[model samples]
Target: MVDDRDLLKVVSGIIGEERTSDDCCMIKVGDDNIILSTDMLHESTDFPRGMTDWQIGWMSAAVTLSDVASCGAVPLALLLAAGLDEPERISGITAGAKDCCERFGAELAGGDIDFHSELTIVTTGIGRVEDEYYKTRRGAKPGDIVCVTGTPGCAGAALEGSERYWKNLVEPLPAVREGRLLAVAGVSSMMDVSDGIALSLYDLSGSSCVGFEISMDNLPLSPGVSPEMALYSGGDFGLLFTCGRDILPVTGVDCTVIGVVTDSGEVLCDGVLVERRGYSHRWMEEI
Candidate 1:
C-alpha cells in the first residue's frame, strides 16, 4: 500500500520540489511575503459523526488557517468552496466559516457553492508576513530543542468518547498567534502537528536533515490519553517547533520542550525507534 506521502512525491515531481516542500507557498508581495495554502475535507472522511454542519464548516477553514499559521503569517482572508448534499447546509456552513475567520482576525472574502453526492469543503487561505519573520520547516540545527504547543491526543480522546475534549475535536483552534511569536523569537523550524507527533517529527527530520530524541515522560498528554495515542492519533492542530535554548520562556504561548534535535537522521522516543505510522490515507495495490 502507498500512503499520502508517497503520492506527494508525484505532486512534487509535477510542481517542483521547492513549491511543495513547505506548509504554504511563499510569494513576495512588496515589503511582505504572501503565504498561500489550501485544504480539502469530506463528510465521510474528515468530519466525525455527530458533528454539526457549523462544526464541519469551522473545521474546513481551521485546517487551512493552521497551514498559514505554520508559516508564521498573519491570516488576511479565506476563500471557501462548499459542495453540499442538501442546499440548506450551505447557510450553516458559511456562517461557521465566517465566524471562524472573524475570530482569527481574518475575513471570509468569497467562495463557491455547488451540489454534490456528499458534503465537501475546500478552503484556501491568504496571509502575509515580513520576509525576515516568515518561518519554514527546513531550518533545524543539531542541538536545537524540540517543542510542541498544547496537549496532543486531545482530539483523539474526544473521538474515543471523552466529552471533555469534544470542542478540541470539533472546533480545533489554529496556533496563529503562537506561530508569530515563535517566528519573532527566531525559532529554527516550525510545522503543525495535525498528523500526530511521530509522523510530524519524521516530516521535520526529512525537511531539516536532523533527527529527534523525544522523552515519552515529557510529552504533555491530555488527561487519560495514553502515550501510544499521543504519539499516533491525529487531528491535534498544535504547532511542533525546534529552537535554541537561548530562546527559552517564549512569552504568550503554552509550549513544552519535549526533546532535542540530533544530527543522525533517526527519530527515537525513549531510546527506541518511533514507527512511521499516523493518520494518513493509504491505497492498496491492484491485483
Candidate 2:
C-alpha cells in the first residue's frame, strides 16, 4: 500500500524539491513573502459524524489556515469552494467559514459552489510574512528543544467517545497567534501537529536533517487521553516547534518542551525508536 507521503514524493519529483519542501509554498512579492496553501475535505473522510454543517465549514477553512500558521505567516484571505449535497448547507457552511476567518484575522473571499453526491470543500489560504519572519520545517539543529503547543489527543479522545472533547475534534483551533510568536522568538523549525506528534516528528526529522529525543513523561496529554493516543492520534491543530534552550519559557503561548534535537537522525521516545505511525490516507495496490 502507498500512503499520501509516498505520493508526495512523486509530486516532489515533478515540482522540484524547493517548491515541495514546505507546508506552504513561498512566493516573493515585492518586499514581503506570500505563502499559499490549499486543502480538500470530504464528508465521508475528513468530517466526523455528528458535525453540523457550520462545523464542516469551519473545519474546511481551519485546515488551510493551519498550514498558513505553520509557516508563521499572517493569514490575509481564503477562498472556499463547496461541492454541496444539498443547497441549504451552503448558508451554514459559509457562515462558519466567515466566522473562523474573521476570528483569525483573515477574510472569507468569494468562492465557487457546485452540486455533488457528498459534501466536499476545497479551501485555499493566502498569507504574508516578512522574509526574516517566515519559518519552515528545515532549520532545526542538534541541541534545540522540541516543543508543542496545547495538549494533543483531545480530538482523538473525542473520537473515542469522550463527549467532553467533541468540540476539540469538530472545530479545532489553528495556532496562528502562537506561530507568529514562535517565529519572533527565533524558533528553528515549526509545523502543525495535524497528523499526530509521532508522524510530525518524522516529517521534521526528514526536512531538518536532525533527530529528536522526546520524553514520554513530558508530553502534555489531555485529561483522560492515553499516551499512545497523544502520540499518534490526528486532528490536533497545534504547533510543534524546535528552539534553542536560551529561548526557554516562550511567553503568551501554552507550549511544553518535550524533547531535544539530536544528530542521530532518528526519532526516539524514552530511549527507544518511535514507530512511524499516524493518520495517513492509504491505497492498496491491486494484486
Candidate 3:
C-alpha cells in the first residue's frame, strides 16, 4: 500500500524536491525570510478517546508551529481550519488554540470552519527567520555532534495505555524556545522528532548525505520506556540537531548529545544497524 512518504515523493517530483520536502516553505520578503507551514489533525487518527478539546486544539496548533521553530523562525501568527459536527466543543478548541499561541508569543490570526462527521483541525503557522539563524536538515557535516532537546518514549508509553505518560503524549510541548536558541547558537542542521528518532535519523542522513552513529547509552528516555519505544514511537516533538564542538548552553532545557554524524550512510544504534521505520498515518492505523 502507498504511504505518506511515497505520496510525498510523487508530489516532490512535480514541485521540486527542495520545496516539497521541507517542513516549512521559505520565501524572501525584503531583507527577511518568511516561513510558512501547515499540519493536520483528525480525531480518529490523531486524537485518542480520552483527550479533551483543549488538549486537541493545543496539540494541533503546536504541531504546525513546531515546524516554524524547526527552521529557526519566530512564529508570528496562525490560521486554523476546524471541521466538526459537534459545535459545542468549538469554544474549548478555540480557547486552547489561543492560549498556546499566546504562550509562544504568537497570535491566532483567523481561519475557516466546516461541518464533518468527525473532528478535524488544520493549522498553518507563519514566522520570520533572520538569514544567519536559518537552519535546515541539509547542513549536517561529518564530525558534528547529534543532539536532542528534552526526552523521548513518553508518547510511546502513552500509546501502550500507560496513564503515567498521558500528559506528555496528549499535551505535547514542542521545543520552540530550545529550537530558537539552537538557531542563534549556529546549529548546523535541525528537525523536530514528530516521527521516531530512527526515521528522523534516516531523514537527516538522506538530506545531508551523511550517516549517524547513536550511542544507546546516551538516549534520554522517559521513565518506563524501552529502547524500542524510544527509538520507534512518534509524538515526541522535541528538536534534534547537529552542531560543531563547543555546544551552546540552551537555557531552561537539558540538551543531550546522543550521537555523531559519519560518512557511512547508515544509522547505527549502539554499533548495530537500526531498521529504518517511523510512525506515519498508515502506521498509526495499525496501532
- lDDT per prediction? 0.91, 0.92, 0.88
Better of 1 and 2 by lDDT: 2
TM-score of predicted structure 3: 0.96
Ranking by lDDT: 2, 1, 3
Best by lDDT: 2
All candidates' TM-scores?
0.98, 0.98, 0.96
Clash count in backbone of candidate 3: 0
What lDDT tens digits, residue by residue, belong to model 1 across residues 116-204? 99888999999998877788889999999999999999998888898999999999999989989999888999999899999999999
Residue 99 lDDT in model 3? 86
Candidate 3 structure quality by residue, lDDT tens digits, 2-58? 568777888988999998767899999888899999998899989888999999888
Error of 2 at 273 (Å): 1.2
In model 3, how large is the Cα lDDT of residue 135?
84
Per-residue lDDT of 233 in model 2: 93
Better of 2 and 3 by TM-score: 2
- Please report the TM-score between candidate 2 and the true structure: 0.98
- Residue-level lDDT of model 2, residues 1-287, one tens digit each, is 98888888889999987777777999998888999999889999899999998999898889899999999899999999999999999999999999999999999998999999999899999999887779999999999999999999999999889999999999999999999988888899999999999999999999999999999999998789988888999998999999999986878899999999999999999999999998898889821
Candidate 1 vs. true structure, TM-score: 0.98
- Candidate order, TM-score descending: 2, 1, 3
